[model samples]
Target chain A: MQNENLYKELLRRFRLKVTLTRLHVLDVLANTPVALSHADITEQLAEYDIDKVTLYRTLNAFTKCGLAHKVATEDRNWLYALHMPDDAPSEVTSDHAHFVCDECERIYCLPMETGNNTRDIKEEQGFVIRSQEYRLHGTCPECHTQFSQQ
Target chain B: MQNENLYKELLRRFRLKVTLTRLHVLDVLANTPVALSHADITEQLAEYDIDKVTLYRTLNAFTKCGLAHKVATEDRNWLYALHMPDDAPSEVTSDHAHFVCDECERIYCLPMETGNNTRDIKEEQGFVIRSQEYRLHGTCPECHTQFSQQ
Candidate 1:
């Protein structure tokens, strides 16, 4: 989708106002394949005159509304990624998983399989399930290659 | 193990200096059934005169050496809990998963299932396995009960 239309439509869907910061955040997240941290966005969007607190709130709003997903790393760093309305159906609040490279600290979004059985898993354990997140941390191909070479 | 031995042996194994701050962190984590955030630890250890920055550093060092596991919630809050030397075998760096209550925002550490096959699952997908973290986000029984009542 084009940046302009994608931004406007997403805001409408999420019932959020159409603002430059929101649009810029979507553009930045949409432009990247890997997840981004708040610092990353602040640095990336610095030219747009967006402040850190607003960027934080914008990302939080986006994640809450399913317009984006939050990525958490081993270092306790949080990253965000775009997840369109279609990516997560009502049944699976977060159907996708993250592949985190322990060496590089990058997060990769994996192709998610539908029908999240996590809800069932928790229910079977006698706990009610609300949502789920799965993250795999390790060396990516590049890091694995370098490690093997060493 | 008692607090005295647990703190001393854990510090020795991690090759860290035994200090009040470090010992306080261990005690705080050891005493809690749930993972704690930096604020939680600060509040819990307030009377001990441990400053917030020192408490934060202690938690970071513990997580790095595997003395504790950092739990990241959906809201991007990081929590810490003890990982006894016996709990996480090298095969599964984090053998357990957490159940985070969306309403009350508490993280419950679930008894881990040993020999996590996430590595194998990713290998089947042609991605090299490194480490894995699984988090379940939902309402706790208390919240669930309250919500149903409402």
Candidate 2:
């Protein structure tokens, strides 16, 4: 399929050896809008019969090669998501904030205001800031509505 | 010591039973300017010979009672810090940012600009934001100087 080729090309671009597990993992990350944990990814790839250690290794490799990124959750766990390199002017791959629902513990991406960038502090403090993560803890719209009803 | 009484009073305020281990942990967190990991806290309290499980339980209790907060690092680990209740207008316990050094892996607290508060998005998007954590990843000044010198 065309999607498989695209995934293969992406692995090549990241200088990773093409593997079936890697392709399937990439496919899952690419399709999911919200970030997912290792357990979540494993559950999604259940039919593939991928080994848990292999999946973790693939995820780690993807993160190291900048193909994917990990967002830390409140429970000291990590959620992985694919980088949207093709989306021009995409905040998903750029500097943005993630809204974490306290109730359901779901992570949602939010476009950050460019005005709040760390350039000012970097210059003033002489720190070489390479990247930033802003995590806003809250009740998501769905959770908020559900809480109000209860 | 007077510090012990103060720590006990803090525990009483949070309705937690005063114990020697909790007092020592609070003392360590109070004196440390930067956030510390569980390992760091354990090492610091090694003289007391505290059990790892007990320390973890104490930390969880502190976090639950708002006596301390955890900042997630680039790694899937957390660094803990105490809440400064007496420092009037202190950003330490308020909504602030944390700078994580990629080289030394040290975490520093940064005072965030009040203008960048999430109040706007909370009103516009109807998300009930309870807290915000901005994590800036970079090389700290010491690490930057060391790397440049080499």
Model 2 chain A lowest lDDT segment of ten: A87-96
The reply for model 1, stretches above 4 Å from the true place, is A1-3, A17-21, A42-54, A87-92, A114-121, A145-150, B1-3, B87-92, B114-121, B124-126, B145-150
Quote the chain B TM-score of every prediction.
0.81, 0.83
Put down candidate 1 lDDT per residue, A23-135, tens digits, no spaces: 88899998987899999988888888898889889988888777887776665678888886553323327556778887788898875544545556677765687566666
Model 1 C-alpha lDDT per residue in residues B1-150, reported as the tens digit of each score: 267886897788877899878877788788877888998888887788787778778888888887777777655678888878664323326556788877778898876444544556666754566556667777877778787898
Top of the candidates by lDDT: 2
Off by over 4 Å in 2: A87-96, A117-119, A148-150, B87-94, B117-123, B148-150
Please list all clashing residue pairs in model 1, or write none if there are none: none
Error of 2 at B56 (Å): 0.9
Question: What DockQ class does candidate 1 belong to?
Answer: acceptable
Report lDDT (CA) for all predictions: 0.75, 0.79
Which 10 residues in a row give candidate 1 chain A its minimum summed lDDT?
A85-94
Task: Choose the strongest candidate by TM-score.
Answer: 2
Give the fraction of native contacts in model 1: 0.55
